[model samples]
Target chain A: MKKEMVCISCPMGCHLTVEGEGDNWTVTGNSCKNGERYGIQEMTDPRRILPTTVVIKGAMISRLPVKTAQEIPKGKLFDAMDELSKVVVEAPVKVGDVVLKNVCDTGIDVIATKTMPAV
Target chain B: MYDIIVIGGGPAGLAAAVEAKKEGVDNILILERDRELGGILNQCIHNGFGLHTFKEQLTGPEYAGRYIDMAMDLKIPYKLNTMVLDMERKDDDTKVVHAINEEDGYMALEAKAVILTMGCRERTAGAIGIPGFRPAGVFTAGTAQRFINMEGYMTGKEVVILGSGDIGLIMARRMTLEGAHVKCVCEIMPYSNGLTRNIVQCLDDFNIPLKLSHTITFIHGKDRVEAVDVTQVDENLKPIPGTTETIPCDTLLLSVGLIPENEISRGAGVEIDRRTQGPSISELCETNLPGVFAAGNVVHVHDLVDFVSQEAALAGKGAARYVKGHLEEDINFTTVNGDGIGNVVPEKITVANLDDSVNCYMRVRKVSTDTVINCYIGDEKIATKKARKFVPAEMVNFKIKKSDLEKYHDGELKFVVEPKEA
Candidate 1:
């Protein structure tokens, strides 16, 4: 199969062409080495990070925003968001506070971006 | 005695004044450097402004006209052509502002509170460090716009735009419509910083070529711009050694970026945000100094004029509260930028009184697909949003509900941009 992809690794959108035969793949048209590797993995397994709001208790607001500290499996976006929805933290939370434990079991924590006050 | 005296008479200043008046501020005046009430809007002949504020599509002048008419109806005091040169804080509640106009020379005023809304200035070739001899055909995009749209003068027959900003894209089509051949638009960045609609309508629709990751390495000209040396760049933004192309053109318009005009703000001892090159303020638009406020481009460069109006209104209202002796000094919490984020606006956050919501504006340092922007209040997550694509060109606006703000008592607000899960 021949695959055409746009390299997002940098500002230079290098049109990538990937050819795969039986268990082997050859990539070309990548301006940089990192983009070549990114194209290969993007062709195989596409993953993304999940950023969503979570329920907050004892804070002034009903919900506080949180996101996976790093990228997770692209196929697990809904699962990650579901996990984040069920996650809640007490108010007076500080920035970078870990609100969720074992998010998607990817060993990544869901962290908060804004400070919240507690009564 | 007046609590605050705002500089500039543009939409930003006008909106600020109106907001202050609506907040019951009786002693407020606006100083405009132009004879008319509207600033840049006086010459903007196209539509597409005021979609967020009035919920109606209007031209730049029309939108500013609406606000000016509103200020007039509200009897907002404004002095035309009053150029503010210097500003300094008198004590805790007073500031000294000096200005000059054709009618009055070296006029000075004192106010209890001050609002800086001088707006922004276009980035010139000198700022970008482009190598070129002094020529007659080189002009800023805004200048060419004013010359053609307002002064009814032709800039040139052939043109080359240096940046893909909104103004440049708009001018690409404008120049094309005026029977000028726009050779191309050169941008060093991979993704365009302009609005998607503009890229489609202005460049794509007009059949203008947009060269990504390319820059004008040098200019070749004597008395007028004759040609530009275009070159592609590597990942590090350094021009690649072998790839160099030249295009012939008589005029070169630069729409690189807009810098906030805040010399007066710095002179007034106001805290400046290094990232946005504007003033750092709380959600109320109150600066670090008491009785001083900032809004619009003077605070941060806004892509849409409507957002500028919205922000200016907040500053105006905040100033009114300061004059009425109702401004809160409980701005204990501060907003901090985290990983992947370029900068955050309204650098301070005060949840002391959670009556109204707060809007936090920020930008990303790089472009990413399927990204997640998270807001953390110290150790806890307050908000997060999934983004399909994030670019440095667009400013992200996030609103924290008053109810949610009440939950977090005290901690620093942080914004983080990271790639989304697979």
Candidate 2:
């Protein structure tokens, strides 16, 4: 079976065609090698870096923006978000500070992207 | 009296203030209208920012935080929630910034040089003239982003975005993640006005249909949004009579475009560029008026925040030079938009003030493939840059070396896009 997908690796947005299923795949129509990798990963097991905000206490603002340190399994995005929703951290949180350690046991930590100074 | 006063504490202002301080300007003040310093970046919670500056993909707030930290570390004084009312040139070459806030009732700031970085505002439904009742469900894409990301409020259950801009595309995915059914994104233009990555990651990833060359003709809503009439347009963007389709959606998000907020700049008697709708500036980012400089979105809407910081840094350095009495007064050669180019920043350039090279940021009017951008000083071609693909959504910067300008000292520098073969 042939599957068609657009590579989101860069601004090029190459329209890729994968000729095989599972581990054996031949990707074409990619401008570069990264697009081929993206196409294959997208077909086999897609993953994305979840970027969102979590509630904060004693900060100038009500919420602190966060994202997974690395890309996680696509199926675990909502689960990670659900875990993030339950978190509440204090102010004086610096960027890269772990908001949720090993979020949803995906071995990926949810870290604060911006610093929140104590109000 | 301050040596430099930066209006708007967003990315541009913060970067300007920090750069001015590094340039040995001791007294600098940043006046921000918002209570916080980040500006619109506070609500822009999505990633894919600061890739050039920081060499990493960061969220909007994160990209802003790095600069905010730098400003704070440099001890840059900034007034929060202070709205600048007016600015006027004084007799002694200094400008006075009059602002009002709850803390400071009314104060006039005296500065040797002023940097305007007030940024841009989202164009609303009224700007587009969509035939509709003033409904509660209609919101700008940025406003919806603020509501969902910062305020933690759900905008709607069913959504129909009216533009394929980056904000609208991001919101389609954002609304989807939060359990909103995004029906479709409508763009009047044949090509999307957003980055191709956004079109793929935000829309294609979520299976959201993007209808190009289509527009919303009529919005059917009274108190709340009920439905919107979508229609396919002809080449001239006129709605075809039989192509109307009604999509029942509770919310309509408008992401038409952004206009630079330059009310204060106009009030200060700064010359406005008819094409950019921002301040007409030199290569050094100096405006028409002496001792006044403009950068970032107030000068023109930048596609990336990294470019905004880079441009604002130049303005800061320019302000420092003006204050220190080191800036050179040289004859400037005007820059003109030639074929296929929409507009170019730094409408003029002075040869003496340039260090090594000057980066001219510009956008093409439309998408072109296998094109060469040629910079001609009068009839003599000075430099040429080739691109595989060029789109209006992405800004292209061409660096012209001082050596190139020295060859053609007194002619108009025109940038034109031509076929690669030609």
Candidate 3:
């Protein structure tokens, strides 16, 4: 079977084509070796980190904005957002303050992109 | 006599005029030197703009069209083919603008305030220090873009593009689509200066090679360009030995960079920032001259046209305030560029009683990962935001809320970007 993946390791999204038998594979169309690993992973499990603003109270605005510090597993994004939806961070919170620690044990933290001041 | 006179008919001018009008400055006129409206957008035929402000995909012309349509609907007065030569502020309320029209060779126009939105000019081969005999085949990326997109002229069959900026990258795909074979895009920097999307859609999708940390050492051509010698560079951007490779091509397209057009700003005795090459304004976009305002590419090179529109609107509104005798002359706070940041616009923060939020437009010196940009009012950190990827090509924008400005009453406000913990 042949599999293709767009490598996002760099700006050059090399379209890597791979022919594999089970776990073993041969890859082509990749300008670099990083694309090979990306193509193989796409065949196994694909994931993306979701960065969306979550509401926060105790600030000037009714809701403060937050985002995932890094991409979590693609399958766990929904559960992550669900966990983030219930969480509200306090103001005067610095950037990189973990809003939700170990969200669903996916080992990702939803962090604040901007600092908010407390009243 | 109008309240405000906006120079240039580009997206920046059109948006600025519309914004000024929206702010209740009725008597406004947009002066465009071109035969028609829609400045640079008239020549650009690619579809990679307006993702930020509009939330939809649009080409350059399409984005400019939206603004043009809005300006027309607002009944904003505009004069086509009118080139402004110089401007001087007579007093706090009066400004003399010297301009020339196609029919009328020269004339002096009076206005209450002025908005400079002349946009920018492309960096040519001579500016980049490309050693070669002056030839006809070498052209700036914008020039080539106009030639191909507007005039329907194929630049060349075989082309080597210098500088991996967005214009060069887009032109690579454009030339290829027009049946021209592009050899490669060479850059002195290790990373791509253009947006990640452009690198993907323009170069990667088209199978064009982007050579990083490399530059064109010399050009080989007699009457026209025949080939170029490209060499890899060391850490200091000095060319490394034994890494020279000559690529044979008939034409060399320079997508090097763009410089803000501020020639008129200098003529008016306005203090220009060496870095931005534009007039140094305060939070109000008011230059050192009292009634003169500057915005858009005349202020700095913006990645997105939407940001240009947004900034120009502020300048337009600010100009209208100056015209209506509601502007304050005393600026309390100053804007300073902090560590890791290249430059920040609106050199000072005016409007003692800060109401609306202020937007600081800047660029980083180098590529950084997982960085947090902090805006400080003296010692107090007013705003801080994290970024995934930071590149010099990408302009970093930081918005300061009115509340944030109120926290620091008076001091030099510094904006800095520092690396964050991974």
Candidate 4:
């Protein structure tokens, strides 16, 4: 099977073409090696960094922006959001502070992207 | 009185203030109407930022935090929740910034130089005049982002987004991730106005349909949004009759366009660029008013936050130079957007600086394949950049070296796109 995808590795947005499926794919039309990697990953097991909000207590703002420290399985995005929905943290949470550990057993930690001071 | 006053403490303003401090300018102040610093970047939580500036993909807040840390280390003072009402020259040199806040109600601050970096605002449904009843569910993409990302509020369950701008495309994914059923995204143009990366990661990944050459002709619902009438547009962007399709949706998100926030700049008697709807600036980011500099979205809308920081640095450097009396006085040539271009920034090139190359950014009018962006000083073709694809959604960066501008005498430096020769 042949597949066409856009490499989201960078803002360049290279159009990628992947041939031969099932763990043996040849990616083409990629400008760089990262594009080729992204194309193959997209064709195979796709993963994405999930950015969402988690409730915060004693902060200037009510919610804090958080994202997976690394790319998690795309299928588990909603599951991660569900886990985040019930979780609340005390303020003075700095950027890169781990908000959730091993979200949905993906072995990826969701970290705070913004700093929140105690109000 | 401060040495320099920066309006809007967003990425642009924060970067400008930091650069100004680094340039030995003391007693600088930043006035932000928001409750905290970092501005819009605080709401923009996605990745794909800081590719150029930091050489690493970072979330918007991380990028803003770097500059915020820099400004803090420099000990540059900033006033949050301070709204700058007006800015005008008190005399030939002194720029007065009139602002108000609960702490300091109605105060006029004086500064030797002012940098306008008020950023921009999203164009509402009213701006496009989609025939509709004023509904509560109609929200701009940025507003929805703020509500969902910052305030932890769900906008709606069923959504119909109008315009395929980056924000709209991002929201398609955002709404989907948050359990909202985004019916479709309708863009009136034949091609999307958003970056291709967004169209894929934000929409394609989520399997959201992007309807090109389609528009929301009418918005439905009495109190909250219930539905919207989508229609196909002809070549001239006219809605075709009898082709209306109603999609049941509780929210209509408008990610149509962004206009540079320049009301205060105009009030300060700065010459506004009709093309960009922002302040006209030289290579140094200095406006018509010598001491008054403008950069980032206040001068022209930028697609990338990294470029905004680069431009803001120029404004900060220009402000420092103006304070020390080192800025150039001669305007050598003005930039002209030739065929197939719109709203090129750095309206004028004052002088060729040995330190930094003059960076020029422009948006193409339409999508063109296998083209070369050519820059010509009168008849002499000075520089050319070849591209496989050129679209209005992506900005073109053309940097003119000091050696390239050395031979040019004066007049207009025009940038145009032409088909690649065989």
Candidate 5:
């Protein structure tokens, strides 16, 4: 099997061609080592840093923006968002404050990106 | 009278005011139209900012907080909810700024130097002449950004975005994450106007399709956007007959382009460049009006906020010099766009005013690889910088040292991109 993808590691956006199946793959058309690594990782277990907002109470704003502390499995994004949708945190939340600890047992915590002062 | 009165408390204005204070300018005030500082950064919740300035990837608010914290630590004064009405130069060459707010009513400010940093606004559907009914579902991408990111209001469940701008691409992901089904993004041009990373991360990652050389011909529905007839266009952007395809969607987001907000600058009688639709400025960011300067998006649209901060710092330092009676009046040479260069900032440069080097920010007309940006002073080639890849979506910062400029001070300087192999 052959898979064609664009490398998202940098602005270069190199078009990579990954060949093979399962855990073994041969990646080409990569300008850098990072692109090659990205190609293999993308073919294997694709992950993304999910940045989204959750509901907040008693804050200047009604919502608090949060992002996964680390990249989570791409397949679990909707499920993670489902978990985040039910979350509601109180204000006085500081940056890096854990919103969802170990979300979905993925070992990636959802943390506050901006400070929200109490209303 | 204030030493420096910065207009608009966004990233550009905040950086300008802070830099001016750092340069020994005591009386500096920043006037912001918003209720608080940070400007548009407050609504931009994404995390791709400050990679160059802070050397770390930070969200929009986090990037802005760093600058806001710096200004606060330095005791810089700024007024919120103040809308600058007009700016004019008095007979004495001193600049007077008029503004209004509910708290202050009407107020006039006097400054030795004024910096324009009002930033830019998104181009709407009307700007692109999209034949559409006046509907509630049509919203500019920035407006939709504020609605979703800040106000927590989902614009629609089914969305069709016009124009492949970075904001549009980012919003595609935002809407998809928020459970909105994005139909597709259509671009009239063959190439995307947005950055390449956006296309890969925002669109490709989410399985959202990008239709190039296509545009919305007609919009359906009177009360809300029901569907849009999208058609592919030829090289001249003329729609072909029988090629219209209607995509059903409730929302139509236009992410066409951004125009620099320069109503105050135009009222102040600053010379405007037709290409940039912003003020024509010198290397020091000084406009034709003495004691007046402009930077950031108000001068030209920049791809990176880091460059906006860097440019505004120069304007701040220039204002400081003007107040301290250190800025010299020197002969300036005009910078001309040659063969593949689209536009060049700092329309002109004065060798005597430059400190070490003057960075000329520009864009290429098209995409090319393994190219060389050649700088010529008349028939003499002065500088040539190699670029691995050049694209219109990215802004190129080309630096020319004062020593190199001083050597050829008489003629016009031209910048052209040529193939390295040639």
Candidate 6:
């Protein structure tokens, strides 16, 4: 199998051509090792770190920005978004505070990116 | 009098204030119109920031938090919810900042040096003059970003984003995550103005079609945006007849362009650059007014936050040097934008300001392959940068070494992009 993709690891944006399967993959047209790894990742279990906001009560702002603790499967993005949208965190929340654990059964926790103090 | 007065508490302002404090400038003040110190970063929750500065891909809020922490660690005093009304350069060479806030009604503060980091504002539908009703669902891309990322509100369900700017690309993904069907992103230009990474991750990842060289000719609906007439354009960006396609969408987001918020800079008698619509500055980020410096989007729009932080640091150092009586007052040369170049920041350059190297940030006017950028100083080639391809979306930083100058010609320093013949 051959897969053509662009590496989003950096702004260099190397176009990668991934061929073969599993550990026997051959990635070409990559400028760096990150692109090679990204090609392999894409061919394998493609994952992405989802960053979104959830409801925050009594905070200076209405929403609190949070991101997945680990990269979740790309297919599970909207599932994670669906799971995260249901969450309502409170103010006085510190950065790195876990907003939701095991989101979408992906075993990745959603943590706060900003420190919100109660208004 | 304060040693340095940093305007706006965003990444640029925070970085400037922190760097000035590190430069041993004791009396420093930061005035932010927003209630929070992070400014736009507070609402920009997406990752891909701080790669150059922190060497890690961090979210916008996280990136801003690092600088905010740095400012707090240095005990830099900042006033929130304070709007700068005007700035005046007194005869004694000091600056009086007129500002108003709930805490400090209308007050005038004196400072030896001022750094302008008021940032930029998004161009709205009205600015673009799209043929449409002053509708309800039509929002600027940045405004929609704020609504979804900070206010916890979605702008619309079925959306058609006009202008494939980075903000619009970002919004296409943000809106998609919240269960909105992003129909497509339309760009009148032959290419997308947004970065390659954004086009790939935001639009491509979601399988959203990007119709290039196409523009919305007419918007339908009275109270809100309903459908827009999308039409393909010629090489000159003029819409072609018999090529109109109407896409039904509840929301129409315009990601046209950004204008620098520099009313106060003009009040201070700082010269403005027509192309950038921002304050023109020296290599030290100092404006024509000796003690006044400008950086970040207030000088010219930047593609990355790390560059903004880096540029602001230069302005901070410039302010510190000005306050310490070390900064040069003599303007050596004005930078000229030659063929194929869009805009260049630090429109002026001073001999004394050049250290190891000076960074000149710019964007190309259009797409070209095998591009060679030549930097000239009074008929002398000072620097050259070769890139496989240069696009308008990415900013090119051309560094001119102090050693390259050898002797100051005291004339125009120009940058011209030379494209390889096909």
Q: How does each model score on TM-score?
A: 0.77, 0.95, 0.78, 0.98, 0.95, 0.97
Clashes of each: 48, 0, 2, 0, 0, 0
Off by over 4 Å in 1: A1-119
* lDDT accuracy of residue B349 in candidate 3: 82
Model 4 pairs whose backbones collide: none
The C-alpha RMSD in Å for every predicted model, in order, reads: 18.2, 2.1, 15.4, 1.2, 2.1, 1.5
**Between 3 and 5, whose TM-score is larger?**
5
Expressed as tens digits, the lDDT of each residue in A1-119 for candidate 3 is 88665665544446678887778988888767767876776666755444444455676444433445554666675677567667766777755577778888977776654445676
Worst 10 residues of 1 chain B by lDDT: B42-51
Put down candidate 6 lDDT per residue, B142-219, tens digits, no spaces.
999998888878889999999998899989999999999999999999899998878999998899999999999999
Over the stretch B1-422, how does candidate 3's per-residue lDDT look in tens digits? 87899999898899889988998889998899986677887666565457566865455656776787799899998899898989887755588899998787898999988999999999987787888787768999999887775554678999999898889987887787556899899989999878775776567756789999999998898898888999999999999999999999988999989999988999988899988988898776889888788888998898878888888878887887887778887887888888998999878886462467777788889888788888877677778867666788888778888776776557888888876845
List, residue by residue over A1-119, the lDDT tens digit for candidate 4.
89888889889988899998788989999988888888888878899988888899999889888899999988888889899889999999999999999999999999998888898
Using DockQ as the yardstick, the better of models 3 and 4 is: 4
| Residues A61-116 of candidate 6: C-alpha lDDT, one tens digit per residue | 89999999878899999988888878998799988999999998888899999999
Across residues A1-119, which tens digit of lDDT does each residue of candidate 2 receive?
78888777765567799888767999999988878888888888898888888898898778788899988898887788778888999999999999899988889898998877898
| Of candidates 2 and 1, the better by DockQ | 2
The superposed Cα distance between candidate 5 and the true structure at residue B225, in angstroms, equals 0.8
Model 3 ranges with Cα > 4 A deviation? A1-119, B91-93, B351-354
Task: Please give the interface root mean square deviation for model 1, in Å.
Answer: 18.5
* Model 3 chain B poorest 10 in a row by lDDT: B42-51
Pairwise lDDT winner, candidates 2 and 3:
2
DockQ of each: 0.01, 0.60, 0.03, 0.84, 0.56, 0.82
Instruction: Name every residue pair that clashes in candidate 3.
Output: A49-A71, A56-A64
Best by TM-score: 4
**Which of 3 and 4 is the better model by TM-score?**
4
Deviating ranges (above 4 Å) for candidate 2: A1-7, A10-40
Q: Candidate 1, A42: how far from true, in Å?
A: 33
Model 4 docking category? high
The TM-score obtained by model 2 is 0.95
